[model samples]
Target: MNIVCIAWGSLLWKPGPLKLASGWHPGGPLLPLEFARDSDDSAELALVLCPGVPLVPTYWAYVDAPDLDTARAMLAAREKITPGHPESIGSIPAIDGAPVQQEIAAWLRGRRIDAAIWTALPPKFAGVGGRMPSAEEAVGLLSRLSGETRAAAEFYLRRTPPHIDTRYRRLVEARLGWRPLREAAVTCPA
Candidate 1:
């Protein structure tokens, strides 16, 4: 069984807890690859974060492909759209092929799952540390999600902005309690 992890937002730059927890390395030189868009849209260049000498980390972007040829094709025709800069586009792999939900389910067994669900709140809702779900919250939410929803949510969280940073530490502290907030990496003043 194979599980695919798709990255979208900040995860594209700095992979969060999920990547770290999954034992995937973060930060490295990126390689340019071409990705095909829907239909006849022009191909875009994407920068894929390559780990050590070989072996790409599954946490970076996982997509189920029926075979190696399909995987190579998907990887070949991909593009990455950078945040705050639409013009700064590149190519990256896009997973599309046979249904691998069962494989994902089997693989998830006995494994720790860390996911971040993305939602669009008003600008005022944006705070520091971004909007990471608490450990309990993440577990609860993922427990009730369908495979596709889970996949989409993972992608969204990876691309979400750091709305929970220092600016609104006070509000978050008051809301979620100081201890958990601190432990969650969203520190606030005492």
Candidate 2:
């Protein structure tokens, strides 16, 4: 199966166990995103899909899996998400025409891929009933983080793909000064 994996944040820099058949390609589908999820694993306000927000370009790479189910399982394992929580993993098969998948389905048209998957974790501020935090609230959470927790948070924000300039990212840059990191320049030996 020609399956692809989509990402916009940490996965771009630290893929951990995700098996990719190709390097990331720019110009993936545009999706609404924000740094709204307070990740338990990293204690960072991680970026997640946010429906009502501005759209940003995501990155895509071919997944090194034989089929969609295995692809999904592989991604779940890489993301550390336990079984039965399929909501955290979004999978769109070319044969399935669910209306909710129209945007991605359209993107799939004329492509060689047979399916695609992405992390679909929801917005979950710590004290806000799993709601997406406002820009101020997100920055406040980042500001309160100290020591290594703070460093991890900043690293996450800075390492996000440069094309993903979300509203919350702008706010974080303005308030916390955690701007995105650019690729380091390479030097030749003298």
Best model per TM-score: 2
lDDT of each: 0.28, 0.80
Q: Output the worst ten-in-a-row residue range by lDDT, candidate 1.
A: 31-40
Give the C-alpha miss distance for residue 48 in model 2, angstroms.
0.7
> Mind sharing the TM-score for model 2?
0.90
Off by over 4 Å in 2: 94-100, 127-129, 184-190
Cα error of candidate 2 at position 25, Å:
0.3
Q: lDDT tens digits, residues 28-97, model 2?
A: 8888888899987787888888888888888888889989888888888888999867667788863233
Cα-based lDDT at residue 48, candidate 2: 88
- Residue 189 error, candidate 2, Å: 24
Model 2 residue-pair collision total = 0
